[model samples]
Target: MAGRTEGADLKSVSPNQPGKDYSRYFQPPSLKEAKKRGKADVQVHYDFAIPEEMAGIGRGKHFLIRTYGCQMNEHDSETMAGILREMGFAQTDDEREADIILFNTCAIRENAEDKVFGELGHMKSLKRDNPHLILGVCGCMSQEEAVVNKILAKYQHVDLIFGTHNIHRLPVLLRDAMYSKEMVVEVWSKEGDIIENMPKLREGSIKAWVNIMYGCDKFCTYCIVPYTRGKERSRRPQDVIAEVRELARLGYKEITLLGQNVNAYGKDLEGGSYGFGDLLDEIRKIDIPRVRFTTSHPRDFDDRLIEVLAKGGNLVEHIHLPVQSGSTEILKKMARKYTREQYLELVRKIKAAIPHVVLSTDIIVGFPGETEEQFQETLSLVEEVGYDSAYTFIYSPREGTPAAAMEDNVPLEVKKERLQRLMDLQNRISLEKNLALQGQVLEVLVEGESKTNPDVLSGRTRTNKLVHFVGDKSLIGKFVEVRVTEAKTWTLRGEIAAKVEV
Candidate 1:
């Protein structure tokens, strides 16, 4: 909304000040130390205010964000983009064409971190060529001490680096970086307070990602989320409901309530006075066409939550409950706080309540001491649940988590083999599940043309299944009924059954 067009002027002026000496901020973090920090209670609720004066400093400039991570990171990039846009920095799709480039990174997987660094390496020439190209990195990866150290030691060209907790301070950080010659590093170590009322440039026209909460309390040994993201803190109920209502009024059809552990919402404030189920009940009243939530922990999921799903309205019939492992022993090792039997029981209860519900899960194939029998237990669980789909992975130890210290004695070849076997079994199950939907009408929120074929429109079922069907491009953003004509392992093919008016 600036009068003067941004991204038109570059090579104006440059002021490089060596960033302030914050060496301690880059020191490697220990899992034990991180655990203690998590235990040390601090304020979870506070008002967040961004620096207003620097809002227009980026007028006549452009910035590009290369986000690497999951949906949370993608959403974080949206917030960052909105912040940059507010500062009059137009977003440039081309990295080399931008005045400033920011990377919103993830630390969940070591490979993800490596990929980020690889990109940084690739962008070194860009920074060298464009001295004014303010390179910034933030998000879960920036929260890691090792990652920070690596960046400071080698990637000195990065102008700014901040963490997940301090996104509200981006404009201030950018101002500091713009004036300074050194890298601006400000990563918070504590469970930072909640930030509400941040502007976001969402990706989809019909669907949006709403962060109902931040961080995770579940210290699954294999996961670095608890350490990187801090603890579970839910957004205020009214704030969440307001977002849903606004999205509905804006004609958005679907809203996914995102959180590291969504089922644990509201446990932080008022000693759990109101829970996630109640929150969903209120959101349902907002009357969005479809509502869904992810990454629910079995330990936090209760009978009440299941009951709400049973009496569904706008809430979708799909749940992405991450059962990290199917083996009870592995579950204990991961500190998931729920046994396999308990998880199965929860699934059973869910199915009883919502009989038509489709389930998807996360599974880790290899662990420190997983034996053949234990691996079999995982396979058995897959068969028992008959999951619609699963995001299966071979365990990859993250440096600062408890699992990293564990002896990775599982042979690499064996781990790969186990992973393949698991996928092979799951593929059959997925194909079988999809085949069962043949000729059945599924309500799909038409997203857009399919990636492979433009003549065919693509969308997702309420159960979160991807379906591609032949239709006009104008069908995008509207819900339509598609009868499954062909079922593949991963996607469904169909012709347009009819249009649905919500």
Candidate 2:
């Protein structure tokens, strides 16, 4: 339901005072050493144990969670769901029908925060009708000092607040909020500590999210991920592999290795025995039918990793390599170390090795001091790459990031125009790409029914292209061959080629 909206402009809601930029503290390690020494020392803390008496407090209650933001937050919601269910809480879809409601939020952009605030306001009437109803907020938004202060001062109805680091303590936090009759606020504002063996309730039966690593060390000047997600920490390789093996045992067909920068996995551990490539090789050996990982940094993407992806049969062919800018000048201002030539070369190498691989990318239309030429360079790059899809946006300055302090020279109207142009180009390319698949059969992993039309089932191709076809509900979670009948800019219309043997 959180699909891209049309002609959305990034607006600044909250502004901060001028100060020495803290963005340098979260800078990505040098390219030469990132694969070797980029990993930070992780101090695992398991001391915040939940009390036994409060374990079954939710025995007669039902709760529901609405997650916003990136995949990382969704995975966190899954963990929270698992925790609540463990304490005897039943899941509900309608917030009014439930005794508790949790909003797992995102603070990447100001609009995200605005949406969360609006939802909280809407839930206020619900709280009035059912005074016993518990309302809570968590995730990256809670990590912000400004967000916490505003919530404490104005949104007195908010029952509980936690941050990215303290999710493992949610059970206890909820219990305290309920009993104390006081607002509960606990957020750690520092590089975080890792907590392992946390509960998780996955949303899908065939697909599972396995966090191979946590946090981001790359502090892009316009981004807030490094601050919200703590310092980077890779999970032990054996632990990750073991988790995947269990998922395979549970009959899961797909596994998405999650992280702030997934490709940087294992750089923080000692002895340098394993890296992301090593983990990919290990996971490929497992019996999971599909393996994918997000958000590889172009600065850390190397030859060895590309080779591994090419070699690994289980690793999917779609790669979401984000090249936020095209001009070297703009990239440097953005603190994206790689140049446009270097990014293109990497793309060339990837395509050379894996000829059928479809490529996707992230692009920001306007930065602090972007010029028309630089914007044109981005347009040229988009044309050159012929991307299968793109996530394009007009830049919004996040408070505390270095770019926020710089003069935003690009006019709002210009930013919107550039974003529209970029989207138009991408849509044309996407349609052309999808057209090539017409009359061809693609292996699609059936996810569920299409939201727009339930009579049609939907899934995705290995290239991560969405496809919709008329099929029985029994086909859900199974891989089926769909012959493309029509091609749209965003999705494919298809028909079942044959009945799946399974």
Candidate 3:
């Protein structure tokens, strides 16, 4: 659920403010408290007051959404796009050709926030040139109090603003902003409720994102997801299954079950008996060719879940189990409940259950108070796990987390050096792992042409390894067996073994 390590290493940068750092503020609803809250009131209908003036305002308008962030934000953009299209807006790639521009932002990192602000400033000129341009900012960043306040006080030109909880209300929000010709700021900072039947314009024809649950209950001291995204809430299992079935009917080849903490699905519900494993079993029975889920926390991973993955009819063998740190001390400070041994045990079970499983992970190199010995623990874990791929980064502190207050003892140079060393180890391991497939044939779902070269097409193996091969453009959405001829650290090169069937 919480993907990255939170909090700033105080030793790395000079503290500009003097106080207990609220940098990583997450308020996870305790399971006890959730029990007392009782049945969540589900709001089924939105009061649609169509602004009279907006009737023809966007009659021939075209809009493009430049989404920046995780799968949650991507799915949110899909709903936003669907809502815009419902209001007679056509999609476009060129920002200059569009009447409306929306930025679906992320606030997990300071760099992310800075990029969004930079884009907003760039869009201001576009607004100045074409005064009718409707600029909106939504998503995690907008949910921040400071971000919203800055937008209200300085960037008054921002026509529309909303947060994660109220995406379904976009049509009305946009209409009101257009009609009033004034700033519209609406952001809710609290655990949110689920709104089902929200429309989505899925980005891919073959692959789709199906949200089985929402929010995170893990209040890792340095994380802000629990606050910004809200409490953990699972969609009705039937709703999720039906959505996947419909996607299959529409000829979708792949479905990724999206969630903040997918492993925690159904824990907040009435029975608490129907968990992620049960839901996976139901979905696996569906006719879809490929099924995958992301971002599982190691703590929630159990034998039942591992067994479900091992059963492996439709479930892809690729698991993105994020091990934020390897040191027990760092893990404790970050509030990751699992120890190094616990994580390795889980990994062993998963691999033992599902052979040839391609494992990927997220690793934070530097946390507050990390020492040479602690850093070695991370490196040793990487060596032991032999992760197929890893996303490694130096620690970045967010506002409102306990780690932000702790002195950052690891120097930036040390962080960089450690990160580089970690990456080097991962690269060697990745190359070694990929080399094992050099002589084998892998089933790869063709995504599209390779970004680096048009002569090649790229797709992913069932284990979620990227495979590039020479293939016809017509084979874009089909699954083909690619014979591995070369192996790179990050990708595999191959040729089509045979003509793709269907």
Whole-model lDDT for model 2 versus the true structure?
A: 0.82
Top candidate on TM-score is: 1
lDDT per residue for candidate 2 within 301-342, as digits (tens), equals 877788899985889999999999889999999888889999
lDDT of each: 0.82, 0.82, 0.80
Candidate 2: where is the Cα deviation over 4 Å? 1-40, 45-50, 499-502
Candidate No. with top lDDT: 1
As for lDDT, the candidate ahead, 1 or 3, is 1
Per-residue lDDT of model 3, residues 1-502, tens digit only: 1111123121211122335342243222223332243255543343443345554456688988999989988988998887777677899999899888999998777888899899898888889988988898988887666676566656767887777877876776776666665566555555455677666788979999999888887877667677678778788888889899999999999999999999998897777898999999889999999999987999998787988888888898889999989999999999998899999999888888988787889999889889999999999999999899998888887665566678888889999999999999999999999899898998999999999999899999899889999888999999999999999988999988975564
User: lDDT tens digits, residues 260-347, model 1?
Assistant: 8889998876667799999988888886889989878889998889988888888889988888778889999999999999999999
Ranking of candidates on TM-score, top first: 1, 2, 3
RMSD (Cα, Å) for all candidates, in order, is 5.7, 7.4, 6.9
TM-scores for the candidates:
0.93, 0.91, 0.90
